[model samples]
Target: MLKEAVKKQLHEGTVIPAHPLALTSEKKLDEAGQRALTRYYIDAGVGGIAVGVHTTQFEIRNPEFNLYEKVLKLAIEEMEKGNTPDSFIKIAGICGPVEQALAEAEFSKSIGYDLGLLSMGGLNHLTEDELIDRTEQVAAVIPVFGFYLQPAVGGRIFTFDFWKRFADIPNVQAIKIAPFDRYHSFDVVRAVCHSKRNDEIALYTGNDDNIVNDLLTTYHIRSGDEKIEKKIVGGLLGHWSVWTKKVVEMFANIKDVQGEAQIPSNLLTLGQEITDANAAFFDSSNSFKGSIAGINEVLRRQGLLQGNWCLLEKEKLSPGQAEEIDRVYRSYPHLHDDEFVKANLTKWFDERQ
Candidate 1:
């Protein structure tokens, strides 16, 4: 059985940022910086966070085996100190080969994480049937958060039938839909509606390009003899990491009127604005050379990061990428929470110091 406490926490209106890694000059985990980042998110009042995921440069897996354990342990420790452990769901990304993913899931459970954000990296080569078998194996060890990551990153598009079968797995709590394409996006919603486990699996939009639109949509599906409607509850996103406090406030406002008679017209307008901002920050114009660095640059400006650094030196922001970010940063003043960061940066950075 799934933990009732966790299940209750896993509903609509939950905003979970795929937490980024804070790196030091020597290219190791910056413990205090990472801790400060965690505290910042908790204070922002996000429902949860996913650590050691793509935003955190899962590349750390190649050189630093023990860092993931350290980060998880420290996050748990800090959360306990905050006295709001039950207020958030702590999810760890478990990717790579099936064996490695299983081992990471096992570790996340031992450290008190609520669920495993499961991704099939190497298994992308497997047939759909074979992939389903592997997914079952991981879900058996711990509750799984299915991932429909976008192809722009390391993600590949899967068949709609793949999602329908995956949803039938009892341990799957939620799926992060980051296809970034509307056609493929609907494919996920369609599959969930057809599944026997429709009510069991929650859908979170990781579609940075369509965040507000995804949240505003109401999905209608036939559950046996009855018709049911669902909304993309919230998001687990890399875009969320930079202007987080603003994202939280926006979520609260959207949730307040999500099922009401008519959503405010401004919300639709905001959707277009958010997509426009994402195009620049995500480097869509330049084919995404500095996606992670772009987020770091925002934090750098807000004094949250030492500099816009990544684990790999080659990952630096391209000239066009930086110019695009500057344009968006100037264009969309309303979308950022820079004032919030400014007010709290002193105390938060001191905690790290």
Candidate 2:
């Protein structure tokens, strides 16, 4: 059964921060550290958590460790411990072959997860019709969140027609638009808006580079004589894993003035500032070599992590990436919720202990 709290949060607009893996010096999943990360998001007041997503590293699904099930369990356990009212939504990343995706979706439902974030990773090179069939198979098991992961990170760009059909699926709850290309991003919006189930499928911005602007955008969709307006209600982003208290506050600020005729001038300026921060944190300016590492660095600075360590040594931040991260830290002090992190870091760690 869908939890009332999760359903309410989705419709009311809220941030759904992506979960990042915390690794030990031995490059193993640090149970304490992972729990700390989950509690941090809860303390920061994120309405939901997306575990096992790209930010958490897809390698976790490999047979050597098979960290997928463990990661999901850890997140839910920590979420339950931290969430006073149990309002936090849990979205497990469900991908791989059709059977694997179906299995994960069933497992997620068994664990009380509200939704499954479906990626087209294993279905690559398949015809669109075949892809749609795979999606429907998983949707039968649980409500699925369609993903538009950027091609920069091994994501396929589904045709607009494909998206239109995908949205029409009854159990597809939302779409995370992260194409990063303005044109392709709109294709998702257009597809959903034109779908008969438009009202049923919500839109979330996974475009880390244009988060603020995406939230501020307004799309008017015309199907027949009826005109329906669409807006990116919130986000499910890896960028949100760090400085999350501030991210939640930023979402609140945007929600306050959504659809207003007189938008605060500062809100416009924030878009550029956030993009600059994302460029550095995402390492987009440097071929994204520091993608996951960049996020871990921020947490390290906040004392939420031991260091910028990953399971794979090759995933370490690129040359000069540290300097770029340091530059953004100094330049965009407003963006980091350092104060909040400092105050809660010790407590978060203490909880795990």
Task: Estimate candidate 2's alpha-carbon lDDT, on a 0 to 1 scale.
Answer: 0.86
Clashes of 2: 0
- Candidate 1 residue pairs in backbone clash: none
RMSD to the native, candidate 2?
Answer: 1.4
Model 2, 1-353: lDDT tens digits are 45667766776678888899888888788887888999889888888999988899888888876799999998888877774465667899988888888898999888878899998865567899988999999988898889998877778878989999999987888889998889999999988888999888778999998998899888887877888899888899999998899999999999999887788889989988988888887889766778999899888888888888877778888788889889988998988998887777778888534
Error of model 1, residue 225, in angstroms: 5.0
Using TM-score as the measure, the top candidate is 2
C-alpha lDDT of all candidate models, in order: 0.82, 0.86
User: Tens-digit lDDT track for model 1 on 1-353?
Assistant: 45776677786458898887787777777877788887788888888888878887767677544577787787877666666656478888888777888888899888888888887654667788877887898898889998887776778889989999999987998999998899999999989888988888889999999998899899887767878787788899999987899899998989988878798999989888888888877777666667888887877888777777888887778778777778888988999988988888777767643
Q: Which pairs of residues clash in candidate 2, taking residues 3 or more apart in a chain or in different chains?
A: none
TM-score of candidate 1 versus the correct structure, residues matched by position: 0.95
Candidate 2 Cα errors over 4 Å, as ranges: 84-86, 351-353
